[model samples]
Target: MKHIRNFCIIAHIDHGKSTLADRLLEHTKTIGERDMMNQVLDDMDLEREKGITIKSHAIQINYPYKGEEYTLNLIDTPGHVDFSYEVSRALAACEGALLLVDASQGIQAQTISNLYLALDNDLEIIPVINKIDMDGAMIPEVTDQIIDLIGCKQEDILLASGKSGIGIEAILAAIVERIPAPKGDENGQLQALIFDSVFNSFRGIIIYYRILNGSIKKGDKIQFASTGQEYFADEIGVLKLTMTPKPEVKCGDVGYLITGIKVAKEVKVGDTITLANNPAPMIKGFEEVKPMVFAGIFPVNTDDFAELRDCMEKLQLNDASLTFELETSQALGFGFRCGFLGLLHMEIIQERLEREFNQTVITTVPNVSFIAYTSKGDKIIVNNPAEMPDPTKLDRIEEPFIKAQIITLPDYIGNIMTLCLGKRGILINQSYLTTTRVELTFEMPLTEIVFDFYDKLKSQTRGYASFDYSPIGYREADIIKMDILLNGDKVDALSALIHRSRAQDFGRKLCEKLKELVPRQQFQIVIQAAIGAKILARENISAMRKDVTAKCYGGDISRKRKLLEKQKEGKKRMRQIGNVEVPQEAFLAVLKLD
Candidate 1:
């Protein structure tokens, strides 16, 4: 057990986390020169395209130090704020973490956020400065920032360039000399913490776990603590570049267990796996995920609802952070109200459903969850706008607020302040981190930043600003549920709860955006944005004019008038019975009203 060192790498997005992992893999000789590729840990196509880690990856490598071989387990974690849940779980399964910071970008928002997560888990921190090969790299500045953030000595921080393979030997030596070996009772009953899982069409669910105590041999009967269902362990193996079957995986080691869990609900991510006969107590350290964004996803064809459900269930096994429940919309038919970590997480899931499962889905407008109090003092949670209570029966609505942290250059601080204030944000505090860097804090509603706030911030700062946020709590607010009515028919899918002060301007933009997207029909279509019974904004698409009057060139004025009146009557009837076919793009346009 003294020879085994388990650690993970945590940093902000694009802070050279994956690049450093690749270098480490090469230094340890885990893969051959010809077989090695960039971002070998990031196997998903979506992840490769986006250049981000969407899932946590774990691999074991053998290293030689001081004439002795040591087994090192490395868990590479995602750095995006949306995928922070993955980072937390990865940090929990390790004894130490490499807090990687970018030399060019310095310590950003996620660097501090992930650092706190590591601190909470009581893990040994090894600070490392990466990307030192860049032309704009500020090694001394980043080292000072790291010192200020973690309070580590100057020599304690390691400086390395992931791209140039500098300081790889030193990093390897630090892990073996500094990080302690995993400690557990090897002779006790089997207790393994399941940190991650993946679904295989041919082999069922493949669970990735780290043994907390005891050992598990191949073909042992195992039981999951959460489900209480027992199954024979069909395969037990350690994770290399590929799955290598081993006869036994003992305590203080990380490996995969295959029990042929074909059902999605049968396997839980954080559940404990123990021997069915001499089961160990369940590990209750992991917390239930609190999703930050809410959206509705429905199948394009209503008949594909069952297939969509199957796809969602399988997807959830891979992404445990996603939460969903059955939902119905008058306009969208049967769908699921999905809770996502953020907008990017929601988009990734939608794309994965289509690209991986071949399931085409429509996503409704994204919003943050709200709490409502009824006139009778009943509390209701409103995730969808349709779930909002009647105006007369409602006491007040409380929306979720978040404490946002923005780290940017001093030049763009003014613009950043304006952007936050425009979204109903209150300035909490501001401080200067360095001569060039300034940090600002604000308190704002979660709903205000759900759309294009990130995009706007990036553009305003010229990609120099880094932002992070956490939910503070709910607060009372004057908000209303606004709905879009087409020809007096309410579209439940287009409804949203908005702040009362900005409703009129937002409604006008939405109505105009919808007008440009919805296709024209024979009859005129009226798009009305309404709050309760009062309409706030309206846009009209005129009916396609026909040549009915062109055929009466020689007719009298009275005959032309008669034909026109008859045409008007027919158009009116069409408007009553004809259904408006809202295209898929129209639903997406609601998210890009700006």
Candidate 2:
């Protein structure tokens, strides 16, 4: 009989998944009491800084129950919707899940979505009501709410405070009793699904998976069904809370297989790892992620370009979801065009690359997908505003839309509704949550909500707003391609698609931002906004005065030539706007108050 129970902890953002994982780790004695951090599962500095789980990490702990050791393989999943795909893959690796519901917040949209996914997987569902230590964590009421939402028997609910470590043992015991054990052919060919993986400077790749059947030791050859790559298992091990690996992990348990595979591509998430002698078919839906948001990332200093790319590559090795392509803009020097799951995902990547990679980077304004339908029946995908077709040549244009769900105190519903309406959003429905918070749904353009929307939402509701959204579809609207002209010349790098009514407002804002961002040039530079032939807004950047004093004439001639050459080189570094290659500060200056 298998002496292991594999399960994952699922919850919405900040509902205490990592904290619970820490408590479990401590309970299992996986680490010494003195060494425990507040959130040990958040191994990345970025994850801790944001107080959000970005990647899925797992650790195994052995608990002594009834005089027998029970191996508890705990997988921690990101609760943010941007990493929803990772959450789905994480669910696949476990035979069961412990749904963490915030006692005060009750059931959220993400809670429902994750629970639905858990049910579809046919994994035994174990609901754990967390946050019981909070003042608002009314356990009984939350329990009733969860039972009503899931339509499950009340007996299935496990009320526990993962924060206080209260009832944690009961929760662990329930996993052993209620959750089903992994069922696979122990005598058949070896098969395991690759749910997640991480890279260690020491160990090339740690591929996490669940063995479907059959067991082999070190020196056994294995093949990834997805990549069709074969390699000898350098070692097989279980991950403990100490974040160290044990020698040998067995069948029916969640663990990592260390092969010579140095990159993430070799061990694709959702792929099957099996014996080379007998290979199984690859699981579908394990393809590399397609980025929804794209932006140019450049180092604060030009010399850091090579370092930036190398850091990005190393980070990508650990996270396959991050995508990058080389790109250089006249405004921004050598930089990379990066793709992300969403706005938050994009920011997180940039922050992490800087923090972990030890490099500072400047980022360009993000652009969204806009579909152009021309009179000639030509279809185009415009990720950059610069690539947008002439407004006159287009028959019609549609922007991607999302169905947003906002949960907030009832008093702020009116403010939220007004804010959405002003952004061309349409109210779909409104409902009540326990007569205190209201659930409001809206169909809004993805573009409007991509930037500054979260900040605005929090500000409007005094931070009472909590919500999630997914792509609904595309809707036709009166959208115009707004162009930012610098010195009366169109800057292809600074184009945007804005609603016709908001064009002038955004144009003026863009020009103002550019003036502040662009450094004082040797020659006075003018920033302008034009729609085709008409200029909507303009700003003038004054000429910069020579600051160096030359005491020598003949001697300084050589130095002056060098100075002029340096000036020319600096001009060359700037992206060409019309006929001029501007300076680096021109790109950095445009998006700020300074």
Candidate 3:
């Protein structure tokens, strides 16, 4: 165990984390040149295409230090705030973390937040300033920032360029020398923490766990402590680029287990696994994930509902942060109310369902969960606007609030403050990190930032501002349920709960967007955004007329007028009878109402 060093690399998005991991893997000779590629740990096509790491990956490598063979387990984690849960799970299985910060960008919001997470887990921190090869790299300034943030000495900060492969040897040496070896009793009771898991159709569920005590081998009877289900360990292995099967894995080692359990819902990430015959006490696992955004996910075809559920189960296994429950909408029929960490997380999950699982789905308008108190003193959790109680019956609504932190340059601070203030942000604190760098804090509603605030912040600050937020609690708000109606009928899937102050502008923009996207029919479609019985905004999509006057040519004016009148009557009848289904794009267009 003294030779085993388990650690993870964490940073803000686009801080060269994956790039650094590639260099480390190359220097350690864990992966061969033929099998190597950029962002090798980010194997998913979506991740590669987006130039981001959406999932946390684990790999084992051997590093020779002082002529002694040392085993190192490296977990490469996603840097986005939406995927912070991934970092948390990876941290739980490690004894140390590589706190990678960008030299050009200095320490950003996620860099600090992920640092706190590592500190909370009692993991040793190795601060490495990456991307020092960049032209704009500020090595000295970033070093001071790191020192001030972590209270570490000047020499403790390592300077490395992931792009040019500089300081790779020093980083490896630091991993071996600074990071402590995992401690566990190989002869103690069997106790392991299941940090992550994935589903394989042919092999059942494959789980990645770090053994805290004792050992496990093939054919051992293992039980999930939470579920109390026992299964035979069909395969035990250590993780390589591809899994390498082994006879057994000992304490303080991170490895994978294949139990041949076909059901995806049966296995839970963060669940403790122990020998069923000689069970160990449950290990403290992760806290339940509180999702920041909620939306509806329905199959394009109702018959595929069961298959989508199965796909969601497998997805939830891989992503423990995603939460879902069966929900039925008046307009969309059967679907699941899915909770996600943020909009990006929701988008990735929706895309993964389509690409990976071959499930075609329709995503509705995303909204934050709300707590509604009724006149009868009953509290209701409203995840869907369609679930909101009647106006007369509801006493008040409480919405989630978050304390947001933004670190940016002095030049963009004014624009950022204006943008955030427009979102109803309240100024809490402001300070300067250096002569040119500033950090601003605000208390704002979580719903305000759920949609376009991030995009606006990036655009306003020219992508220089880094933002991070944590939910504070619920606060009373004058929120109303806004319903969209097409041709006088409500579309429940297009309903949303919004603040009363911004409801009119939001409704107007939504109606305009829908008008631009909805197809024209034989009759005019009246699109209305309404709150309760009052219509807040409206738009009309003109009918695709046949031009009855074109055929009337040179006839008497009365005759032409008579023809037009009859046509108008027919159109009015058609409008009364014609039923409209809200376009799928219209639902998603609400996300871009910038």
Candidate 4:
């Protein structure tokens, strides 16, 4: 067996993890002059556009050091907290981690969280401070913080600039000397854990597995430890850090296992790939992640619903991180309730689904928590407008909250404080990085941050802020289940709960934002913003001035009269209790507003 060092590069979002990987690929001569691709591990176009890592990817390169060749299996993982579950899975496939800390920014909340996870895995960590080429770099201070906070040896932390190729050779030397080789039972049964897989149109399901023990080659039968289904290995190959048609991989190797499989339901992440005739005990440390945020996704054009469904299913084949179910709303005809790891993950998934599937969609406001209301003997899972109960019928409603950690420069601290206070934020504590940057922790309701909160924060900070959050304990705050009534009936798609003090303002803002989003109604549409007993604001939509004027009841006068009668009847069905002609878009618009 070859000397293999399997490791993953982990850091906070945009700390140069991808850039470091790119530098390594170039430094080790893994890419040729003709290859000409930048940030090769960021293979997906969608990932680059968003400036975030959405998936866990890997590559292999052979580096020569001290007259010897060492095989480096480099795994790249998402740094965002939403995708932390995937990060754990990726960590399971590696023996060590290269923790990248930005020289200018120093340690962050995400960096601490990621470091804690690595420690739990018992993985050897090699700290490397990156971005040394930038102005105001502080390599020694960050190195001191790593040693003081993490209690690691001072010499173990390497300093480098991933962007300028500075200290890259030293990083390679540290990897060869500090990180250990892979170890497993050489004589045990042929067992492996399938961390990730991909289904190509031509090659079928290309399963990626790390061999735990024993060995198998072409013609050997393998059984899925989870499903007990068996298949023959038609082909086996390693993802060449640098070429197509990857080389064949064997035991103690991290590579792709092609079984000539065509079924999507058969292969799953976290499944076990073992010999068909013999099996071993399952690995001890795998955990299923529960989604923390959700939203409703629907095709802009109803005709494309089927296409959207197919694309979602196809995307789910590779990304087991996403969750969805068939859902419907009075405002939206039919759609799927999609679950995501976090806000960024939710946006990335939506963007990829649209671009890859060629489908345009209308997405609801992303929700951070699913409130459950139990009043009297009734039980309700309040997620949408229809599920929201009347205020009088409710006894108590439970909402989810989050523990948010923000890292930012000192200049915008006052603005962030004001914005958080407006969202009913409670201060937790504060820490500082030297004297310039501060780590401010806050206990904010998840619902407040899911909406325009992110955009608002970015605007206030001039894009200098970074955020990470996790679920905190639930709290009982003043909650009101507000319902939106179109005319006289309730609209499920436009239902939400707001604090008593903000109910009127929330309603008014929602109505206004809706007016801006939705087009004019065919008939004179009336938009009224109302609280329980009083109307706060009202707008008069002009009547359908030009529509139906041309060829009015021309040929087939009876049919024309019938149509006009139907239109009038439709108008009557609309509630005119307060001289308001509520259009369909009004409900949709309200749903998207706050």
Instruction: Compute each candidate's TM-score over C-alphas.
Output: 0.99, 0.88, 0.97, 0.87
Tell me the tens digit of each residue's lDDT in model 3 across 239-321: 99999999999999999999889888788888899999999989985887889999899998888899899999999999999
Which pairs of residues have clashing backbones in candidate 2? 330-575, 487-526, 517-589, 517-590, 574-582
Writing each residue's lDDT as its tens digit, candidate 2 over 111-214 gives 77778877877778888888787887778778877777777888888777777898788888988888877787777778787777777778787777777677
**Model 1 misses residue 524 by how many Å?**
1.1
**RMSD, every candidate, angstroms:** 0.9, 6.0, 1.6, 5.3
Clashing pairs in 4: 385-492, 386-492, 526-581
State each candidate's clash count.
0, 5, 0, 3
- In lDDT terms, how accurate is model 1? 0.93
- Among all candidates shown, the one with the greatest TM-score: 1
Q: Write the per-residue lDDT of candidate 1 for residues 337-415, one digit (tens) a residue.
A: 9999998899999999989999999999999989999999999999999889999999999999999999999999989
Cα shift from native, residue 582, model 4 (Å): 10
Q: Per-residue error at 538 for model 1, in Å? A: 1.2
Model 1 collision count: 0
Alpha carbon lDDT of each predicted model: 0.93, 0.77, 0.92, 0.76
Candidate 3's C-alpha runs over 4 A off are 547-562
Model 1: worst 10 consecutive residues (lDDT sum): 547-556
The deviation in Å at residue 479 for candidate 3 is 0.2
- Descending-lDDT candidate ranking: 1, 3, 2, 4
